[model samples]
Target: MSPTTLPDGATLRTARPGDEPGILHLIHALAVYEREPDAVENTTDALTRSLFGPDPQVFTHIVERGGEIVGIAMWFVTYSTWTGRHGIWLEDLFVDEAQRGRGYGRALIAALAALCVERDYSRLEWTVLDWNAPSIAFYRSLGAIPMDEWTTQRLTGTELETLAATADGGGRDV
Candidate 1:
């Protein structure tokens, strides 16, 4: 689809094949913003394959202003057994440091929200670090409530592999 114009004059659109570099740049920049610059292990080639491969698992939307990419939102859909509907899970949303405070972040979120409304997605959701006061405030201003009762747990690296291996033992609990 063609990029849509935002109130701020920035344009938002689904990322094209050549947007990997810009997407990776923002990914690393966001790592720095989250105080984990050294934790980013994703390469552009991996990102390219993940987003543009034959069976892409994720989608990204980018916002441009004056011909330069200023923000990006990478997301995927998740099914909720309780709601019996798919919801958009925003993995990351970031605006370049120089372009922040210009409503680019809000524009990116609004674009995703529009997609939710169009697709009958049950919800639009994402996680924010507790230490990120600015981001928390911004989300609150948009009427997003904190999921304080829920604790997020993740299994990755060796732990995930170990769990999968357990299936060989009849997948039984100890």
Candidate 2:
């Protein structure tokens, strides 16, 4: 796909192989922005493996201005049974602190939404932390409403394995 221009003149495009390092930098910045600097568990090698591997499950779009990556949107596709269609589940949306309020964040989201429409996806969705008032407000202003009726659930690490083992006919070998 060709480059798309953001409101502030930044260019947005799909990430490529060499962009992994830049994407990792943004991921680290995002972790710090979210007040969990130590939570970034993926290294450059890991990011490259998952994002550029043969069977990449996640995707990203990078926004750059003046030869530097200032923002990124990381996401994956999900299916909505009721809608009978696939939708985008945005995992991360980050704009460098120095670039905030320049329309980068909104541009990233809008770009993704456009992709959803282009690909015939049902919708684009993501969750914002309850304490992130700024982000919550920004999302609300974009007409993205909260799923107040639903609660997100997740199981990771050993818990996930343990839960899966239950279906192995009481075998904990896994």
Candidate 3:
């Protein structure tokens, strides 16, 4: 595959159906970077379906260098009640260790932010592990502020199913 070149030889482009394997690889790399290598329970099949299924819910951009995928940024839109507008939620942003010093991270974030501006999204948000200093610095450099006033809550696994089953008037499942 001929490498598409960005200004510094780092090309950023929307992922294609043929890039499933590359995307999975980048996801694994990201898991490793986050110190949760064993937490990547997702399969290529799951990723393939999630991104390109009949009803696609996520979008991704792959960063290529020398004709090889070196990084990825996956994102989706969410509604913010306070802003009353659609916002971009960056699900994952990962760059290979070898490619870290380059401008891929900045490129990816800029691309997402530009998309938000062009599409009139009220905000762009993503989370970083509290201990990830380098990432925190990068985000800060881009003028992102920590939402210290709010905390993230999640319901997953059996809890999610149980909650859904009893959402309306406390069903029998509750």
Candidate 4:
């Protein structure tokens, strides 16, 4: 996709090589904003491998201003059996605290929505912390609805490892 020029002169475009550091920085900042500063274990090298590796499974869009990254939308594709098509799962969306209210966040999300339409994807979805009232209001203004009936579940660390150990492997290599 071609780079888009935002109203504030920031350029929004897909991330490329050498953008790992900036992207990781935004991710760290996002963690802090989410009140989980110590939860991020991501590294620039890991990002390079996941986003720029031979078989990339994830992608990112960045907003850059004055040669510095000020916002990012990191996402991946998901398949829905009901739709029989793929959709986008937005993993992260963040703009620098100082850069808020300039429409950077909206631009990033709109870009992802555009991608969804262009690819015939089923939907564009992400989760917001319930306590993030500001973000919830912003999303509501953009016409997003809550998936009230669904609850997110996850297993990590020892729990994840223990579950894997319980798998029989079905006589195949794990």
Candidate 5:
């Protein structure tokens, strides 16, 4: 889709294949905000491959102010078997340091919410770190609630690889 210009001299638009560098730059900004810059495992090539390659597994939207990318939001569709419909899981949202107070963050999220409503998505979800007070407040202002009953868990390193390589313990390394 073509970019949509906002009245405030900014634009909101879907990401394109040519936006790899800009997206990666914002990804780095997000990682830094999360206090783990070195944990970003994605490079521009990796982002381009994952976002715009043959499979096109993810979607991103960007906010540009005065010709510079000021914010970004990346999301993907997920199925909620219990709900039996598709929902949007926002994987990352970030506004550049210098642009934080300019309403770019809210505009990015509002655009995403607008899309969710337009597409009839069953839900729109994202997680904020517990210590991120600013983000938590922002989310609360948007009427988002904490999924208190759910605890997120994940397996990584050896455990993940082992599970991937093994079956239900029949001949799989008991």
Candidate 6:
């Protein structure tokens, strides 16, 4: 996709080799905004490996203004058995608090939607904190509907380890 020029001369484009630090910063900011400031354990090295490494499965798009990254949309592909196609799972979307209301957030999401359309992806999806009213309203304004019938579930830490220990191959590497 071509780089997009934002209202204030900011450029929205895909993340590149030297973008890890900036992307990681936005990730930490996102964690803080989600009221989980201490939850982020991401490092630039990990991001570099995941986003720039050979066979990278994850991707990120960022907004840069005056050479500083001000927004990000980090995502990965997911397969839906029902649809028989791959879709984008937006893991994070964030714009600097000072840059909010400047259309950066919308631009980031719109870019993902454009990518979905371009690649014939079936969906672009993400979860928002239930109490984040402003974000909920923004998403709704963009015609996003909630999958209210579905409940997200997870098994982490000790539970995840316990479950893995029960695998048929005794959790041997595939």
Candidate 6 Cα misplacement greater than 4 A, ranges = 169-174
Give one digit per residue, the lDDT tens place, for model 5 in 68-173.
7788999998888987878889999999888777777787788888887887778889888999999999999988999988888899999988787666664444
Model 4: per-residue Cα lDDT at residue 18: 97
Clashes in model 2: which pairs? none
Off by over 4 Å in 2: 171-174
Over 145-164, each residue of candidate 6 has an lDDT whose tens digit, in order, gives 99988889999999998988
Clashing pairs in 3: none
Give the Cα error of residue 40 in candidate 3, in Å: 1.2
CA shift of 76, model 1, Å: 0.1
Per-residue lDDT tens digits of candidate 4, residues 1-109?
7999998789999999999999999999999999999999999999999999999999999999999999999999999999999999999999999999999999999
> lDDT tens string, model 1, 1-174?
578898778888999888888888899999999999999899889988999999998999999888777799999998889989989999999999898898888888988888898888899999999999999999999889999999889999999998998877858775
Q: Each candidate: RMSD to true structure?
A: 1.4, 2.7, 3.1, 2.9, 2.2, 2.9
Deviation in angstroms for 94 in model 3?
0.5
Model 3 residue 158 CA deviation (Å) reads: 2.4
Model 5 segments beyond 4 Å from truth?
A: 168-174
On lDDT, the leading prediction is: 4
Best by TM-score: 4
TM-score of 6: 0.94
Over the stretch 82-145, how does candidate 2's per-residue lDDT look in tens digits? Answer: 9999999999999999989898888889889998999999999999889999999999999999
TM-score of each: 0.94, 0.92, 0.90, 0.96, 0.91, 0.94
For the record, the alpha-carbon RMSD of candidate 3 to the native fold, in angstroms, is: 3.1
Worst 10 residues of 2 by lDDT: 165-174
RMSD of 6: 2.9
Clashing pairs in model 6?
none
* Model 3: lowest-lDDT 10 consecutive positions: 1-10
